[model samples]
Target: MSEMLEVKEQETLSETVPVFGYELIREVLLPDILGEETPKILYWAGKNLARKYPLKSASEIITFFKQAGWGDLRVVKESKNEQILELSSEMIVNRMKTNGKTTFQLEAGFLAQQYEGQKQVITEAFEHPKKRSAKVQFTIKWDMKDFA
Candidate 1:
């Protein structure tokens, strides 16, 4: 009975939301305002977070993205039963600059850097470090068509 209580406690703790900020930055706020570079870092962060939580399929990942308010998840090119998912967020163009050299920047340099600092499980840079503004691309490949 005590073991059950302990498990319950852990579950409760994990579901608790903080009053400070979100663990995963939403997809909508990444691209335009954050710059072209943010999509990759956000995508990587989303992937890592999904793995940590371990969703059964890509659709589940989409749902997770939606629930997080990242943005509208869309399948751009679907071949056979597999498709590529593209996530985008609205960006405030004027807010894209940072004062630091490389590390101070977010989205491309800053976003990737911060996501890297999380030590979650992401290590891939979506774009070249020097160029923080680029296309936002994330590919989701799977065979489950009706997955949610």
Candidate 2:
């Protein structure tokens, strides 16, 4: 008489999973592939992504960033045609501590494109990395006359 071995079924569960080592893609591979044009390319790519995921309001946009692992996005100041935003996170702080020259061009471009669509005007964004504060700032500006 031969004994048969019983097989166990694998567990199948659904849950939200966090992505790890995204910096390797953002900080290393992308720059290596794009070379000198990394910043510009990433900026345009971010704008393209913003078009795909059009958020209705600034709060929604901020929520999107948090859900997408971008960080905490907050409007520090807003004027007639200009908006200043700050982004901070544990990842950002760690990156700043380890790397002195981190760029946030992708975030800048995303903000620029989103603002342009929301205001129906041509918009531009500049990124300022605060190494000391371990944060990144974005300044989005638009001209009143130029309609998008």
Candidate 3:
């Protein structure tokens, strides 16, 4: 009975396997393959993802980011034409701490595309990475005249 219980427990534990070596693909391999266009490609891919998800509100967007393992997304500020968001995560910190000049254009572009779809406008996003703080701030802006 004791051996059977141990086997069951081990099986349960083994069901929850953790993924490893993602950084090698995301940080190194993709960049090496994409080179100068890595940022652009990532940004567009993020936008494409947003289009598929099509969230309704800012809170939903934040939740999506968390669920997608992107990071903690918070609203720093909001205005008639712009919204500022701060993103931070373990991966983000590790990248910033080790790789001085890394970019999170994917997150920025995702926000931009989500906002654009929601507001029915042409939106653009810019990323500002703070290495010391190990966070990325995204500023998403839209023009009222450019309707989608």
Candidate 4:
């Protein structure tokens, strides 16, 4: 199982897919089907995905984001109970330009779940999309006294 997971992660690292298909589903089809609840549903879906593909550390989470074509993620700041991460990519820029209502809730939820798994604490994440900068900032926070 571990080997298969490793292979799956590595396989997509260098693979490329046409963005049109991805956009067609994510931007068009999903919104059409999910309607106003799309962001909320996608956020929960991301958390479920994290559960299925748990990573042991922050580095692994970063790699997973890249492999999954989310973006280039970097830790901007870290403190005792919170961490700030920034995500950017050409795809992100394009999405922001094309869709004014773009949301990064999915990535935010993924980060929240990943950190919860790693820290064994109750964690939550908030997404701040900077349309002007074409980047998304994720603020992941955990209650030190709360355990998962």
Residue range 9-121, candidate 2, lDDT tens digits: 11112333343467777777887898999889989988997887776678877876776677999999999989999999998997787656567888888888988888899
What is candidate 4's lDDT per residue for 1-148, written digit by digit as tens?
2355589967776877899889888888999999999999989988998898888888988888887889999999999999999999999999999998888888988999999999999999999999899999999999989999
In candidate 3 the C-alpha lDDT for residue 94 amounts to: 88
Clash count list over all predictions: 10, 0, 0, 0
Q: Candidate 1: misplaced stretches above 4 Å? A: 1-47, 80-82, 91-135, 140-148
Alpha carbon lDDT of each predicted model: 0.38, 0.80, 0.82, 0.90
Clashing pairs in 3: none
Candidate 4 stretches greater than 4 Å from native: 1-4, 13-15
Candidate 1 per-residue lDDT, tens place, 1-148, comes to 1344345446665574542233223324344466766645555555454344444444644554444444444555656433344545432111223212122112233222222333333333332222254124443233333333
lDDT of 4: 0.90
Cα deviation at 33, candidate 2, in Å, is 0.7
State the displacement of the C-alpha of residue 92, model 3, in Å, after optimal TM-score superposition.
0.9
Where's the lowest-lDDT run of ten residues in candidate 4?
1-10
Model 3 local distance difference test score: 0.82
Clashing pairs in 2: none
List the RMSD of every prediction in angstroms.
11.6, 11.2, 8.6, 1.7
Cα TM-score per model: 0.35, 0.86, 0.85, 0.94
lDDT of 3 at 54: 77
Q: Clash pairs of candidate 4? A: none
